[model samples]
Structure formats: structure tokens, C-alpha cells
Target: MAMDGKARSAKAALKRQAMKEVELRHTVRYGIKQMLGDLMHWNKISEMGEALQLLILNAVPESALLYRNADIPLMPAEMIRHHARQGIQDRLDDLAGQMFGASHKHVIELLILCAHDAGPEGSAKHLRIPRHEITINENVSRKLDQARIREELRMGRDD
Candidate 1:
């Protein structure tokens, strides 16, 4: 009888753990989806600050709600900005070989613009190019600043 009770208890514990894992996965998925939706909406309006705030809010449900209620500060804008820049930089590094006729400066600016225009997933696609023979200009660095500024302005982005 005691052995049977132990077996039952173990089964119950396993069931509880499984249920908790499923709940956690659901919460994370919901959070990510909510954040993505907010990002898309804010992108259209060009309200970067608000968009970042929404992202932070979605990332942490309880904290975000508390912040909304008590007016406590949530995530920092600089952290989000840094994350976005780092994401762009990593993508650029991965696609360094595929960028055609693009200088390092141009690549940096293009990455920022692409991140704003396409988000992280879309920016990944934009960075992918057909790998083939390409010419590297000897003066790649000479016009980098000019190209970067030009691309930034053309894409309606600053930085």
C-alpha cells in the first residue's frame, strides 16, 4: 500500500511538472507574439521610443503592468537600442561576403535602415545574397562615410 502511494505521488509530481512546462512555453510564445505585433504597428507610425516601450512591456507581463500602473520605469531605451544595433551588427558580419559594392560604412548604415524597415527577420533575408564572383574596390574606405550618410538619408533614417 505504501509503495502504491509513493508511485501515485511520483506520477502526480511528473504530471504537475509537465503542466508547468507547457504553461511556461505558452507564456513565452504569447509574449513574443505580442511584442512582434507591437513592433510592426509602431514601425508604421515611426514612433521608435513608444515601440521599444511596447516591446519591453510585452517581454515581461507582470513588470510591464506594474510599470503602467505605478508609473515605475520599465526597460531602458538604451538597452533596446543597443540590442537592435547588436542584432544588426551580427547580421552584417554574417553577410559581409554577400554585400555587393558596399563599403563597411555603407554596410553599417544599411543594416540600421534594414533593421528599421524590415525588422530582424526581414533584415536577415535582405542580407542574404547570391554568392558569386564580386569585385572589391581598392578605395573601399575612401567613400564609406559619404555612402553611409547617403543611404541613411535616402532610407529616411538617422544614424
Candidate 2:
């Protein structure tokens, strides 16, 4: 039996999955990167003050921060001295916990990237291309089981 009352799987996938220190560090850093990316994409966090609050408070659940409007507490003038301190490295390790879940880095990169680059495309001009010549038929791409298993009755084919 599993700790959660669920029966343990005979294969025990968790037992086989172990991350080395290098791989684990990379995974954690990547998760941190993605966490900040997720926030920047939605434009929630802007400054170090916000980043400090989010990281310290553990409000980031599931690798994403739950936005509480205008609730971002400002870092006091005293705390600003160690904005990117090493002490918080431990917090960044589990920034996105296995169960629950940025920083000064990813947000800074995005702020610069968005400022310099165009939208997703090389240029920002909206694509006004018409969709007529796009000849991919929707039906061809639909699910193979689109036709449900109706009652075993032999119905005439609508097609």
C-alpha cells in the first residue's frame, strides 16, 4: 500500500526515477526559469520587490503564483541590500516543490527580450493572411473514434 492509501504499483515507477546532483540542479534551475517565464508571460511580476516576496512567502503553488491583486508587499529598504543573496538559494531549490511550487534572472531576461524583439514573429505587424488556401480538411485530422459506438443497431450512413 502507498502512503496515500493508494495501492503501490508493482512496477513502482517512482523507485526507478532518481536525479543526479547535476541533473537535479539543472532541473531545479530550469523549473525556476519556467516559473519566471510563466509569470512574465502573464505580466504578474515586475520588480525585485515582487520576486523577493514571492520566493520568500512560498505562495507559488504548482509552479505558478496565485495572483492576489495589489497584495505584493514591498521589500523594506533594509532588505533591498541583499536582493540577490545566496541565502535564498535553498528556497530556489524547491521554488517549485515536487508537490507545490523565480527570480531576478528570468524576469530580467524577458524584460530585455520583449523590449528589444518583436512579437513571436520576427516582426510585430499582425499577419493579415487569409485562411482560404489552407487546404487541411478538419475531418481528415479529426479523431479516429469520432463516430461513436451507437447501439448495435445498423443505421444508414449519413455520408
Candidate 3:
């Protein structure tokens, strides 16, 4: 019983220490300090202020851009989640990575990929073609012309 009490006290101490570290970390002037702490942890940012700035300056702006895209979100939840989870996970994955046990990953991916700007004809990074040569059917075209000329001459001769 004494050992259990000691372990419980140790765990409580550790939790308090963690909370203190978060509080001591560079906090943004923004009102959402706890959210900043979560963001810092998620993005591997050592300072909470930097994470807050990132959310405000970078993540929000990028989502606004996606808001205009009108092409990625197959369902309402995808767009909602992307806006909810403000981080790099969405940028890394078309489905914007899993969140809250949402099951629309595959559908969102399809919608993003099928968008006009996302495929090979647009923003695709790597593209491949089977043949490199650009050739016209000169020989066949020449033969067809010759046949037409001969027939025209034959008709003239008959006339």
C-alpha cells in the first residue's frame, strides 16, 4: 500500500512538472495557451509561442486557400476536420490524416486526387510517358497521295 501511494504521488508530481514546463514555455499573447501547448506538442515545436504563431499565421491561411479550392473535401466532415485539426497532417495527406475516428479517409483522398489541379495535367510532381519519339506517318501518307494522283491521271486519260 505504501509503494502504491508513492507511485501515485510520483505520477502526480510528474504531471505537475509537465504543466509547469508548459506554462514556462514561451507563451504567445494569444488567449489560447492550452491549445498552443497541444499544438507545440503535435508539431514538435519547442516553444508554445511559435506553435501559436504557426496556427495563426500559417495554418489558418493555408486552410483559407483550401476553402477556395472547392475540390478536395468529398464530405462535410473532411473540410470540417481539416479546419478543426490545424496542423501539418492535413498538408501531408490528401485525406488530411485520421481524426476523431472519422472513416472518410478513402473518399476524401479520391476527391482530392480527382480534382483538376491535383492530377498529372496540373500540379502532379512526377509524370511518365511510354514513347519518347514524335513521328508522322510520312510513308503511308506519301503512298496514299501517289494513289490519288494515279487515279486522277487515269480519269484524265479516259476523258
The global C-alpha lDDT for each of the candidates, from Candidate 1 onward, is 0.39, 0.34, 0.37
Residues 1-159 of candidate 1: C-alpha lDDT, one tens digit per residue? 256888997896687565442111111111233343444554452444334333322232222222222221233321122123333334434444445444433333333333334565553333232356887676886588779989889888653
Which ranges of candidate 3 are over 4 A from the true structure? Answer: 1-135
Better of 2 and 3 by lDDT: 3
Ranking of predictions according to lDDT: 1, 3, 2
User: How many angstroms is residue 150 displaced in model 1 relative to the true structure, after the best TM-score fit?
Assistant: 66
* TM-scores, one per candidate: 0.19, 0.20, 0.21
Question: What digit string (tens of lDDT, one per residue) describes model 2 on residues 1-159?
Answer: 335434354234444333211111121222334433444344444554344434444322332332212232233211121233343445554553422324433323223233223333421221122235656577755543354434223364543
Highest TM-score against the true fold, candidate: 3
| Candidate that scores best on lDDT | 1
lDDT of 3: 0.37
| Residue 155 Cα positional deviation in candidate 3, in Å, after optimal superposition | 2.4
Model 1 deviation from the true structure expressed as Cα RMSD, one decimal place:
22.2
